[model samples]
Target: MRSFTGWTCLSNPSTNHLASLASAWLLWAMMATSLLAQPPLHVDGRRGPYHDHGRHGGPSGEFDLVEPTGAVTGRISLRRDQLIYRHGDGRQVVYRRNGRYDTPDGQFLGYYNTLLARVLKFPRSGFGHFLYADLDDFTPFPQASYRLLHPVGAGPIGGPIVGPWAGGYMTHDISVYGGGLGLPWLAPAPAFGWGMNAGPLGPMPFAPFPLNPLPLSPIPLNPGPVPIDTRRVALPDLPPAKIRFTNSSQRDVNVTLSDARQAGLSKTFRLGPAETHDMKLRRDAGHEWVETYELLSPDGQWITREVRHSIQPQPRYEIVVHEWRVQSVAIDRTARGNNRIEDINMQGKGIGRFLLPPGPELTDQTIDVFQSARAMQNQGTVTPLISDEQIQEQFRPSDRVSPFERALLQQQRAIQQAQQGQR
Candidate 1:
């Protein structure tokens, strides 16, 4: 034994070192094994995919901004109908609500008014304080002078509503901004009834963490022979229907066929690879039929929730045809000039939304993870609803905070808190 600054040392230091190494190796192996045990991960990127990497420009250049004219450095919070601009790199000058401000970039902006202050703000003939600015990018996103229209509102969000307007463009600035939103803003603030309860679109977890989306639980699965959760079917009341989906794409595709929600049991049969999924759907009458192809993103998130109107009986076989909902910014106008900056009032604005179709379906393995989620008529395990806290704990959030994001989050929180107090 050797006496060190501490005390006595191992007689054979090599043995001690070997033991330590063994422990570390064991821990690492366990960690890796656990990671591998996670459900076969996938993401769907087919829906109106936005590559916004400076694509689509005149001849060759970074993608042009939709606004043909505007302060080059300023940003319009379209989701919130707010505009902040500056000519050079000086401090930003925010255009006020129900106000119109001209940008050196040749753009005109109008912020909407709620307190009847609109009539005093813009050209009396039309555009009564509804974002009637005229940057005139020639895009058809409802850009008439009358309160400047925007093809807003997602497809009937709560239920079913297909919007006619194409969505806004994908920009690098917003990407960075949205990333900042992921920062943690726990302190309560005053609420000013901002369109987006979470403030401007920040990257996630940072700003727009307003239960914006419930943290999804990853499916617990081993990457081997896919397990079929034979228990659940589309409709339990109706007779069992047979269904099959073949993965015809060169790349592996995940197909999920869920029956119309009714009765006690809603069946969901999951399949993958090139295999044809043989599943069941309720075979009664009424609104019956599986919604076609909910293409998952590469990361296995549910993309579209389109309701299938066509009802039918099985055995049904569907060929998984790889399709894409090309997404690009376009101009939408009208002779009557209506639905301008419109649907936001209906769809709960401020989340920075563009027409988003559910991307392709990569995988629905989470269906297996929902082993606990199966609580229809108590046929399966009755587990408590997963809490957001539990999810955050498991998936530790990052600490990426930008200076601008931090300030914005604080301001939004203050506004939110104030609003709450008034209520």
Candidate 2:
């Protein structure tokens, strides 16, 4: 029988075998080319199908895949007719019933109006005074204003037939303000007595009062003036702080500081338009740092605004080495199922075979390595001495195998010794 070793020689009797070997070599070359054609790995650890990088694009110029958090800024206004009301009892209320109108830009804005009325009450006595008081009662009143007897019990001998009359009065002047009611100075009470409850003058059957209408003396209508638009006025802006980072740890850093409330700083205070502020920052030993800015408006509104930066450390690399020995092997004879071949070559220094789907192949070989430096390099986990030219150029005579590789080699030697003893 011919020995398998040194079998490359092609003689006339073995030409067929030589042809078969050449065909196998060609198939392997094709498979290697296909594997090499796959695209590069991405930051997210995916192998790409190859995409276009625009003309102006570079690796460093790619948009950040992560979305950033941010803020929005704008303005808002209050409507008119929303009355600010103060009652006689000193209670304050806001009336909001008046409808809003559309702005030139089709936006709905607010509005206001003023209304007035007079409240009257008959005195307890038929002879008491019809006293009038302004908002400030202490102020002097114009003289010669006629005084009428309090309508209470002022008929039939002394009072109207309306039985002892409860307090009562009349008002003809009234108006509305900001969807609320208002009252100006009360008019002088007339001298003629409309007998209480005497039909119209008493009980119920009486015509409305015929008080002499003096030449419509126009009491100048005075509605309180609307407040000035203070929103447009510009407020003072804050100065920016000079910020600096002590550590060169990150590509960007962010720092934030709020003003002390005791410093008369209001929460609404913000950096003015077209203004920039600087802030200083110190490094925290052995920790990362981020800086941020919080802008505020003068009136304490939080004007949405922010600026961010980060600081990061330098890049680094490490070399690793490893070795291994064969433990045991078993020959597989069955060839009808998926169990064709997993591996063949043992004690190799590189990645080995990866199986494909099941097929009917009687003569196939697969190689697998349990601990190979080349496998690590192919996976991009560790730098290999032969292919990592940059690392090789930077190598020093004192640097040797890494600790992990040393341990692996030690284990491999022990396994080899044990195998020899078993033999």
Candidate 3:
């Protein structure tokens, strides 16, 4: 027994110390088990649960401006045809219904003719005050002088300014004077001349004050090539009188041939790998034979849907069943302007792959995951649908796992693999 400052303790010092140590060991063991139970992460470099990290605008009609690295830095709100952009850096800009736009600096209300704008390397013309014209001999109007507004926020004056336009630049010192509302006015003002600047609101050089040519256009980002969905394609139907089916695949298949029009007229047969079976329906004179066939796996799993074929029972018709497989593939667009196919290894950690179909349509076109699976089902192949939970599990990372926990997970996976191998 010992007396402390505020409370009295009655226990052996060595037992207390051992109790504390056991509590700590139990806590550490629990934590290690938790870490080892976590699933492995995907190496696909995709945005995980933090995809909407900086997302503030949650409603519709509001879009978060995301950077290339998936960070949300700003937001854009849509009001009919107008767009108001606000950045976290205290900058605000508004793109009006007209070609004009307003910013903290000044308003851009002047626009060159569509034809001349194209020659000056302006962006593609859209609907509104500007005419979406083509490159033809038709010239609607000559280039006119733009109205000069003195105050910064004041609207455009009026009429056009016409003069002998030589290549020059416009130098504006609008930040000198103040507008009525304390807004700074542009210095030297602006006079329309040859195109200056590079972007949408680039300054144009006043005529006869030419310095240098306009800067080159910015390069555009190239996303990987678009994948074509083959499930949407409509295939032609086959109509034959008599048919012979050959199991050209590696696995034995169970097939059922039946008369589609008459019930109780069916035959079930089993075909080994590379084996062939011929089936025919009893047809009367001048009558047509409508037959249907379906396939199943050796384990009694439905592989394909029943397909109807019109047969004549005249010439010998043969059909081959090819094996289907699920392959993991990814598109690597690292090379400039080229999309290359790269093989991926799931290794019991990653998720996703393509279900390859048999025959000519399987060229460079890789089918979509879900679509390919459904297509295989329609073609009588047993395919399992990937769940959303499986996808989320693949995105989970094991970085937080300690070395000891990692070793435990590896040992568990090895044991599982061994058990499977033995089975």
Candidate whose TM-score is highest: 1
lDDT of 1 by residue, 302-420 (tens): 35433334333333212112111111112224533221211110010011111101112222221221121122223222222222333223221121223453454456556555655
State the C-alpha lDDT per candidate. Answer: 0.25, 0.24, 0.29
What TM-score, computed on C-alpha atoms, does each candidate reach?
0.15, 0.14, 0.15
Regions of model 2 farther than 4 Å from truth: 1-214, 218-232, 248-423
Question: Could you tell me the lDDT of residue 196 within candidate 3?
Answer: 22
Ranked candidates (lDDT, high to low):
3, 1, 2
- Point out the worst 10-residue segment of candidate 2 by lDDT: 1-10
TM-score of 3: 0.15
Candidate 3 residue-wise lDDT, 7-89, digit = tens: 11111223344454553454344332222211111113322112121232111134444454435566545444444546779
TM-score, predicted candidate 2 vs. hidden true structure: 0.14
